[model samples]
Target: MKDLKGKVALITGGTKGIGYGVAEALLRQGLKVVITSRDENAANEAADSLASKTNSKGAVIGVQADVRRLDSQKEAVNQALSTFGQLDIVIANAGLGHFGSIEELTVEQWNDVIDTNLSGVFNSIKASVDALKESKGYYITISSLAGTNFFAGGSAYNASKFGVTGFTQAVMLDLRQYGVKVSTIMPGSVSTHFNGNEPSDKGAWKIQIEDMGELVVDLLKMNPRTLPSKIEIRPTTPPSK
Candidate 1:
């Protein structure tokens, strides 16, 4: 089993949804968790809630960082190293989605999604690679099934997710020789605050947030020699048509 006690993990966009869930699981495993959100207040609330439930305030630190900005990512890493002294895991879960016909998708909208979902991952890995190298750490990206399946109005979102999966796989190869394990998790129709949809909305009919959290916990416990590079999680049952 992968030993997580005494480990340190940095989760981006961790104020809610899958990101927050992953942080909660890591904290419960006794790993020092540093979570980042664009909003300082939200970050504080999430950190406090996780720490309170885990009964380990010292092990949970919250930082405010815009995933789209490299400078913000730098601050996040600095805060993590300062608070935890090292880093062992990174979950690049920060992303955005905008759906529209390719012709209707404005250039600005396309840029926004690509910058936050793809370039943001690059910035995150660059900032944290050294620490990961030092720790033989693991890196996981919260990609999407949209990366593979394309829909008519999903031009921007599909391209963005496609870039994410490809980028994650390439980085995994680049870092594997350095003892770092990289993986991308793709979930289908998860009920979360992804895109503009509130997780608690009435239309929510898919996998629960906590189930993905449990999946992350399970991944953490997998053997080191085995790296499940690509994980696709979908609901066992879908809504009736």
Candidate 2:
């Protein structure tokens, strides 16, 4: 991490939003990057766009992977290793939310939220832990403030993020002895397409995707002895309630 140049990173759900932003930041820092999306076309398009925008010292590639399936995640890790020869960072950024009162939430909706937001994080780490250990690398998961706070209609989203927060903390303990660092980032609100929201000028008050990207870069560059295991970020201000 001292040089960052030429290090390799594998990011889940990197076609857009936070994942895409993080990929761009890492590329600018001279780290080769592999971004995955369930949609092959989106993944390739995003990679091409990022390559065109950044005068990166490193390179970027796109892969088709689904975090919900362990095999898919494993394939992504393999692709990264085959393409870049090493994997130094893994970001579990793919996530989704389904909000509704418990009574109104369907079984399918609950499954979708848990599968993509919680189980997905597990799959990402499980797939890349060995590569990380080999490189003495870093693993980061994108959680949310809802992980610690709860609301009436946020049962599914809350449960998944809460799981992510706890899981990442425990994984940190498990991996630190091997010289791998683990951390989870929890953000209150961001300008992204999550839950069908559009990113636009109206959301200027919210945390920008680039802000999250910067945080990840900071974490990766932090001194090896220091670990900021859990971080919670929120907008500086919000409109009057």
Give the candidate number with the greatest TM-score: 2
lDDT of each: 0.87, 0.94
**Tens digit per residue, CA lDDT, model 1, 66-185:** 888888898899889888899899999988887888888899999999999888999899888988999899999988999998889998888888888999999999999998999999
CA displacement after TM-score superposition, residue 123 of candidate 2 (Å): 0.5
Question: For model 2, how does the per-residue alpha-carbon lDDT over 152-176 read when each residue is reduced to its tens digit?
Answer: 9999999999999999999999999
Consecutive 10-residue window with the lowest summed lDDT within model 2: 52-61
After superposition on all C-alphas, the RMSD of every candidate to the true structure, in Å, is 1.6, 1.0
Error of 1 at 109 (Å): 1.3
